[model samples]
Structure formats: C-alpha cells, structure tokens
Target: MKFLIVFVALFALALAAPSDKDTVIVEQNSEVLPDGYTANLKLSDGTDIESSGKLEKAGTDEEALEVQGKYTYADPEGKVHTINYRAGVDGFQPQGEDIPVAPVA
Candidate 1:
C-alpha cells in the first residue's frame, strides 16, 4: 500500500525530469599524435570550445604539455562570453571580459 504509492510517486517524478535531447553536438573535430592533440566542439546550445596541446621541451627534464584554448558560451542571462586560456608550467591562465581584475594598490 504505502510502498506502492511511494514507488508510483517516484516514477512520476522521474518522468518529469528534463531531457538533454536538445543539447546535441552540432560539430566536433579532434586529432591526436604522439606529441600532441587538438579538439574542437560546437553544440546546439551555442557553446563552442577549441583547444590544443603540444609537447614542449621534449626529451628534456623540463618537458611538459603546453596547452592553449578558448571557449565561448552564453549565460542564463542571455549574455554571450568568450574566454581564452593557456596551461603549462606557468599554470592555467584564463582571460575573459567577465573575469575580475585585481585593483592595483
């Protein structure tokens, strides 16, 4: 009785959940090699991302992957934003209009 009612309620809620059918990948491209890789994606939701990584200082003790990429997306407020970034020994550094800047002393 009680258990049956709970099961039915849970089933109903599950059916009401939103589906991701609308958020499809409109375009995608990628390539990989022994030293590096690249990727790009565009989604129906108006999000785009492009990235690539290269082996830097290869065959050396300081060898590392240097990555560079950018992404653009729209916020819930309907405002579109773009960000460019790099990652490597220096760490992930991102630049965008929405990113805050520290006030100079």
Candidate 2:
C-alpha cells in the first residue's frame, strides 16, 4: 500500500541520517598550518575519546613543520590514561604512563 511504502522510506531515511550519537564529533577551528585543534568523540556504545594536536617550529620564519605535538586519551580496563607524543626529523616519540600496556611476557 502507499502508506506502507511511505513508512518504509521514512524509516530508511532516519536510519541513514547523520548523527553524532553514532559517529565521532570533530571540533577543529583552524584552517591553516601551525594551528591547534582538539577533538571530542562519543561512541554509540558509550565510549569517550579526546585528542589534540598542534604544529610547532624551532623558530620563527620556519616554512615547514618540524616538531609535532599531540595528546590523546585512552581508557584501559576502566582506567583513564593520558598520552603525549612528538614527531619530527628525529622520530615519533611517545611518553606516558605504562598503565595502558599490560605486563608483557
């Protein structure tokens, strides 16, 4: 019936609609290099994620990215964790608590 078809179409559209509850929410206010940004995402299954990044330079008048600063959130076994990382010509270096990693054999 026509009513049945309309109902099915509406249902399909609702399911396909974009929703933050089911997808990650991005919060960036930068449009150029050497800018900072942060992101907060909530998963459908009740997971909270927070991250941030920014560009840094050794000195002014620098052209390209040299050192990258970053931070991320991790929840391991219901324990909250914070991680900080940096990357450049040297290499990507990460420093944080060992709580995220379990004892390795």
The numbered model that scores best in TM-score is 1
Best by lDDT: 1
lDDT of 2 by residue, 2-91 (tens): 232243335333433464335443332322233544434443333333334444553555522333333343343556455455544556
Cα lDDT over the full model 2: 0.41
User: Residue 16 lDDT in model 2?
Assistant: 33
lDDT of 1 at 57: 83
Q: Which stretches of candidate 2 lie over 4 Å from their true place?
A: 1-23, 34-64, 99-105
How well does each candidate superpose onto the true structure, as a TM-score? 0.76, 0.39
Q: Write the per-residue lDDT of candidate 1 for residues 20-93, one digit (tens) a residue.
A: 54566778787776687777777777777777778878888998778788888776677999988887889889
Query: Which residue segments of model 1 deviate by more than 4 Å?
Result: 1-21
Q: Local error of candidate 2 at 101, Å?
A: 12
Candidate 2's displacement at residue 19, Å, is: 14
lDDT of each: 0.70, 0.41
